[model samples]
Target: MFTCLCLISKNVFKRRNKRTEFEILERYKIVLEEGFENGLIWEFYHLRGDKGQEVCRIYTQLGNVDWHRQNQWPEIYNFFIKNMLQLEENFLMVKEVVKEELRG
Candidate 1:
């Protein structure tokens, strides 16, 4: 009985991880769909699924920013920071919901 419970717990944990990962990617899809208002663009590569892509990365680029001018740096930096905080908040929200469902 103890061994059965252990196996069941393991399976539940695995399922939770996969579901949470899927939810996070769904949020990323929304981000990509919405694009950036500050002339920035988002890109994500899932390397294992990309074949010879070498590495996976999710990042923002300068896009239309005039990086040649130093003043533009501050605004872009702030934009990046704000988005990161939002992402963190989204993740926590997803995590809690996932946890509640799995717990039930």
Candidate 2:
């Protein structure tokens, strides 16, 4: 019984990981389709599947500063832009990871 439980848990873990990877890839595709450089950010907040629920959020950078508020700090805007770039890179990496996992 213990061995069966362990196997079951392992399978569940693997499934969850695969689901997460797929979700990340899907989100990445959506982000790209939405165009990261078009002054619009694609954010995925809630991801649900058979394995469970996961949250994937990606913020795209806007080249214009027209949206900046008068009271907003310069550092905050810089950080936001940096984070957006990181998210875009992360999505690319995650897509490769998912492809490898699927191949294996």
Candidate 3:
């Protein structure tokens, strides 16, 4: 029984890791589609499945800045606003808690 429990836990962890990798790839594609080019950074945290974060830095050929207050990429900006928590400037961090209950 103990061995069986260990196997089950291992399988669960493996599945979770696979899911995390897939999610990161899918979202990175979305970022590319939104015109993110050089300086794109992808980070994945080992938090709960429902908790995550995203940060974007704007550049106009000069390079990354401390902050950018304009919605230069409205589509991307709106997407972030709808999906993550918007902080000052163009930085966005995913909310730790989901606002709406997901349906099965």
Candidate 4:
């Protein structure tokens, strides 16, 4: 199992006289400097698309589709949520990269 962690942010934009749109923002990916068997790699990006509809797109190289839909994803989701919450708590001055050091 390749434990790759990716950060996905979905943004919905609404403006008068314009159709609503959604954007998936991916920031960066986190990976170990040296390969580690149990290590995780996370990637973040910014996505833009039509709003009010589910946006399903492939995240190439992130994981297998079956794996995301069937196994291990819930736990992965929880991990991402937890990390996000922690990051939000310090949104003012903390850099996302600091999470690596804090994990140590």
Candidate 5:
């Protein structure tokens, strides 16, 4: 059997008040990339919907998704967990700021 890790984390933006997603995404990328020591860099992969417009939340992976069931699952999971924790720590830096922005 094989394993496919999916949906590590995501963000959905409403683009209210005519705010552009491109600007928002770029800002977010910087915010996330800051202190994002994870080796796996999650990008905007359009799995479905219009190629230019996505109506659903953006999905990203924290580790290698495809793996052989008995080959390296443990190692991959451990590494992913480490990165996830790091991501959390980094996010904590700007979590309140982001929340306040969202409330606007």
Candidate 6:
């Protein structure tokens, strides 16, 4: 009886884990779609959409002159810029690339 109960509990845990994983993946998909849409907006306008400035502000606020070195600013800025550039490039490439011929 104890062995059976242990096996049942293990199976229940596995089911719950799988369900949680699915939910997390769904959430990630939603976020990626939103990011892509926002990137599209930014690409055309040369502007950072809604959350963009806020994210930069968060980093700025976290970095104090006393604690965070001034030299790190360029590094952080470049990192964010690189990511934005990559996203923009990906969006543009997708828009220009034709995959219909390959499908056939």
Best by lDDT: 5
Best candidate, TM-score: 5
Better model by TM-score, 2 or 4? 2
For candidate 5, the C-alpha RMSD (Å) to the true structure equals 6.1
In candidate 2, what residue range of length 10 has the lowest lDDT sum?
1-10
**TM per candidate:** 0.41, 0.31, 0.22, 0.26, 0.49, 0.27
Better of 1 and 4 by lDDT: 1
lDDT of model 6, residue 98: 24
lDDT digits (tens) for residues 2-90 of candidate 2:
00000001232335664554354564464444433443333334444554554443334334344356564564566566655555555
Q: What is the C-alpha RMSD of each candidate to the true structure, in Å?
A: 13.1, 14.6, 15.2, 10.8, 6.1, 19.1
Q: Hey, what RMSD does candidate 1 come out at?
A: 13.1
lDDT comparison, 1 vs 2, better candidate:
2
At residue 73, give the lDDT of candidate 6: 65
The residue ranges of model 3 lying beyond 4 angstroms of the native Cα positions read 1-18, 21-33, 46-104
Query: By summed lDDT, which 10 consecutive residues of candidate 1 come out lowest?
Result: 1-10
* Candidate 1 lDDT score relative to the true structure: 0.42
lDDT of 3 at 33: 28
Please write out the lDDT profile of model 4 over residues 76-104, one tens digit for every residue: 56555654443344332434554543344
True-structure lDDT of candidate 2: 0.44
Task: Give me candidate 1's TM-score against the actual structure.
Answer: 0.41
Model 5 segments more than 4 A misplaced: 1-31, 34-45, 48-66
Off by over 4 Å in 4: 1-47, 52-68, 92-104
Runs in model 1 deviating more than 4 A are: 1-20, 23-62, 66-68, 99-104
Model 6 Cα lDDT, one tens digit per residue, 22-97? 3332333333234443322111111236433211110111123332666766755654565455544443444322
